[model samples]
Target: MPAATSTAEAAGPTAERAPHTGPIRWIVVGSLLTGLLLAAVLSLVVFAGAPEHVITGSALLGFAAGWALLAVLSAWMTSQPQRWAWVPTAGLAATGLGLLVVAPGDGGLTAAGWVWPPALLTMAVWIGVRIRRALAAGSGRWLLYPVVVVIAASAVGGAVETVGLASDDPGRAMPGEVYDVGSYRLHLNCTGSGGPTVVLFNGLGLTSANWARVVPGVARSARVCAYDRAGQGWSEDAPQPRDGNQAAADLHALLQRAGEEGPYVLVGHSIGGDHAMIYAARYPEQVAGMVLLDATDPYRVGGGPPSAMAVLPSLARLGVGRLPPTSYWSTLPEPAAGQVRMFNANPRGWRNVRDEIATLPALLTQARDLTTLGDMPLVVLTAAGAEDDPARLAGQERMAALSTNSSHRPADAGHGALLDEERGAASSVQAVQDVVQAVRAGTPLL
Candidate 1:
């Protein structure tokens, strides 16, 4: 009886500690979950309403579903916050950091770019403090939990960055003609039947399909061709560097090989203007007229690649090759929307974009010396909304001055005005048709 009583006394303190320890465990679990939820919310903010593109309803739903699943897991693993829940908590933190890097610079605070890092770091510090205090008090050793959490988070992030979600259906080629340009196979789509072939060049990081909205209208008057550059759309990556000169060379080769005879009216958007200019300069006889659509000026694009461009390959390594459900697609119709989705899924697209950005400085430098058009009919279509900047308008004016017979038409549209849902594309089509008419008539183009 004395032995039994002594044993009961020895177990009394441990029994009492159980209630006290339970509350502390719950507190730790709560803190971990709060950190994770905060991280996830910040990520959502970064991806949603990003300045680069509009976040689609489906993407938002996917984000919510991803968060909800994590939340449920966090709740279920409350008892094992240190052992089980920390992995996801660290994952949330890593993903938030990745979002900070991927979020467009123009997004500012709305992107939650400024908020996430500090919040996540603070949480990590807080966790460390708790672990240190617990150890000092001789309560328990909690160091392994935080470390494991961090390692697990990094692993998941690395996996995501490396293996990322590739589309099950990746190879949906655009409806077009594929040409073997020796170095690469370039995809070209054409419509209508007439003289002075209208060739369309997509803006930076965009595919030939970007002109889908405007092609039908232009095809009514002239044969219009929109071709994807190497490593874009249905085209394969090229051994040559992605440069304006290379692009111009590829276009010339494709035209010659495909038996698409020209005297062509070249239409270029954004950076494509540089390539069109190069094409006209290199093969003067082949180009009859030129159309510059909200194009980038060689002088205006700053020296060196953008900081974001440098970070893209790193993000790709982190398994985020593409961010889909872009806002631009919302403006497009059904078949076009579906095509954009497939384009978004292509991992090579980002690699190609990176290469283009890397070579922009060199391309712009090369463009500084492109031969003048002399008297070739030229039309410069400036987006009214984008031309609000005096400097931008000045650049557009300068482009119009490239030819003795040139006209600058201000369209009621934004930078990507051709893709605008309303009359933006129609305005551009009219400009192209007018240029074609002027070139054929040998009349002065205002």
Candidate 2:
């Protein structure tokens, strides 16, 4: 009796661990239905005022069929590691044909938006499931890393493609400017005022156009210019780097090239915040003050040694641009579509942005340690409603104190909050104004 009881106990754990059943199947099916419904609704909004004859029920049916075909193909091909290469190669070919043959017509199929969405979704979910299965089967550690690499590359390429298309499109530009500053074009938009210059830097995967909402208000009091960095928006590619020191040099050159006056104040967002740090460190004489908006910490963030995939961005090219299943990892609730699409065929400009940003981890860490701009005043703004991670805020405070001539503290603002809510935006703008005032008054603002 005792032996039988022991045997039953030994087998209990195995019995409890069962394979996924009907509920899991239902969940996947439901998600598919949800995606289909969402796609149909979005199509309706896009084709709303078009001739009823044009956006007929049959059009929706065609779209559904197209999505189904894409999903099936993506699921099958993404399983093979080597097939990942074809995704980007195909994307580039499609993009080339798009740029040469098809332009973005009023409502016609353009290269930028033509081949994404379905491709991205089909790819991401498929890759994710692959990863999950590998983990379940306790796959070899070596094989898992390579799989991750392919996914990240696809993500970055997809982002770059998305941003490229948006920036190149003629209708998308501001009335006064045609260039996005991320590339080397030096498309600086300076305020009319002759006061000290306030030069702003954008974060990863973003163009200078991101500062549009803040520029108008800041320009009212002083000269504020925002331009995209190289390989971002409409800016030219980088000869050096989009890192801190390089970014600072770019800003200085732009001031000289554009014939804008300076003794500039630097304002940066996310990775741009790190760039600001480097600029101050390298050229303290040029910077009047700095405001870091949720900058990445070189020491703790990717500045340190990254995974094998992060090191070889090309490896990422091979992954089916799938993202983490939830928003736990990234700020975006929805993963950018370009990541999953075949890189060459994706018309979205986002892939380029992702690719450029991923390679900057080591450079960003180097940027953070630069402290020559210490004489300048500093204000670090962190997001309030962000994940309650003390390490993040503490790191900012530590960096700020180290960089400052005097005190260290937090500015009362949230990450990207300035653009969203009334109070948040007001606070962000006010913080900039305060720095300007301090600089103008010749006071120690840090």
TM-score of 1: 0.65
lDDT of 2: 0.53
Count of backbone collisions in candidate 2: 47
TM-scores, all candidates, are 0.65, 0.53
Q: lDDT (CA) for every model shown?
A: 0.65, 0.53
RMSD value for candidate 2: 15.9
Model 2 misplaced stretches (Cα beyond 4 Å): 1-168, 175-184, 239-241, 303-348, 385-387, 403-413
Predicted candidate 2 versus true structure: per-residue lDDT over 386-428, tens digit per residue: 3478788677776677545434435455666454345565666
Q: Give the TM-score of candidate 2.
A: 0.53
- Alpha-carbon error at 263 in model 2, in Å? 0.7
The best candidate in terms of lDDT: 1
- Give me the displacement of residue 39 in model 1, in angstroms: 18
RMSD to native, candidate 1 = 11.6
